[model samples]
Target: MDIQRYLQHIHFAGTPKANLHTLEQLHRCHMLAVPFENLSIIYHQGIHLTPAALFSKIVEHNRGGFCYELNRIFALLLQQIGFQVSFISGEIRARDGTFGPPFDHMALVVTLDQPYLVDVGFGDAFLTPLKIITSEQQPQASGTFHLEHDGDYYSLERRNGDRCSHAKTLYRFTLQPRQPEEFNGMCHYHCTSPQSHFTQKLVCSRPTENGRITLSESKLIITQDRQRKESTLHSHEERLAVLRHYFNIELNVQAA
Candidate 1:
């Protein structure tokens, strides 16, 4: 990996190599810098899975992407900076709530001094990687997350209140190395499937000084703890203006 490009993409500074400090730094940097976006997926371009291609599109082009693009790029940067990293795909349970096959989402299962579930692109996910061993409720800006291990698989559960909602058996991964190309089929499916959420909604999310700002379709939702607010966009101007006003994303992406 090109250190310069990695640094430039994530805007990492003060250190070049990966350390617990730098990892924490990079983790925060990634959370701030790169948005979890899927515009390219909606724009009719095939999602690129290779690290080289991922870097070219993200770092070189200044584009944001979905989980596959965001996490894949982050994984490479970690490796380039000398962190022990590995790739694994995640499966997203359907809204109707059924565990699909593993080709649902792409994620990473990282092993360091201890195991961690590191992902920067899940959008409003765990602020820091969840300690794989910690079953206690880990607090995040988004919500609370806890991991439960069952046999050989793990489930990531996210909750906002007493009610346990939005639980995704995120992914089941082993300590095995994965090539970027291995995610191509799933990536394509995510980008192309009409049943897929990405194909139906124009969504982008980022962390803000207060809480989080999420643009779904045309509605803007802002939440800081129990205080949640929303606005209904009536026109393109409203949508474009709202995106810039909050999330800092430009919808008018130029074509190649």
Candidate 2:
């Protein structure tokens, strides 16, 4: 893996020491730089999970990807920078209090002083890495997050007081280390299955200093300082402009 290129892609200038501070800085930078997008599925372009292909698409072409592409390649980059990283599978919790299949999402566990759950793929979730313990609410720019342990599994929850009466469950995961090849079946399923949300939408989102900007299909939503401004694009050209202006992606899908 090209460590220097990956660091340059994330626009990180901090030290690469395998410590808490470096991990926090790198995690935050990656979140702000690359986006969480699934435009490949929308365009009918098959996504590749290999490190080389992901590096070329993200770093060279300045595009973002879903969890399978984002977290897997991120693990490679972190490993190159001397951080002990492991790829873990997460099952996303639906709104009806049910969980998706295993390997529905991809996350990382970096072993520093303690284990940290690092993810740049879960769109508008935690900006920095979350500690792998069930104690202490992890504060983020978005909101306070918590992890609840249930026997052998861990549930990731976000506090949603105003929008909902209870804490919202984001996903459930386990500490079991996984190989990249293990996710290939679900990765293909996500892109090909009609029930998969990725195959159903064109979403490109990234976090800003104050909030986040998401371009889903023709709608452009910008949330800054707790205020949201929504707009609709009337033409493909406008959508392409938004992709280049906001997310820094230049793709051939404008004509699709």
Name the candidate that leads on lDDT. Answer: 2
Candidate 1 per-residue lDDT over residues 23-106, each given as its tens digit: 777877787777787777766767767778888777776667888888888887788677888787676656666776664566
TM-score of each candidate structure, all chains considered together: 0.85, 0.96
| Candidate 1 segments exceeding 4 Å error | 8-11, 161-176, 253-256
- In candidate 2, what are the lDDT values of residues 1-256, reduced to their tens digit? 7788789889899569878888888889899999999888888878987778999889898889999998988888788778999989999998788999999999999998889999988998998899988868776778878899998899998884443446888999999999989999999999999999888888999999999999998999999998999999999899999999998788777455
Model 1: lDDT to the true structure: 0.72
Q: What's model 2's overall lDDT?
A: 0.88
Could you tell me the lDDT of residue 201 within candidate 1? 80
For candidate 2, the per-residue lDDT at 46 reads 83
Q: After superposition, how far is residue 176 of candidate 2 from its true place, in Å?
A: 0.7
| Error in Å for residue 87 of model 2 | 1.2
lDDT of 2 at 183: 92
Model 2 lDDT at residue 190: 94
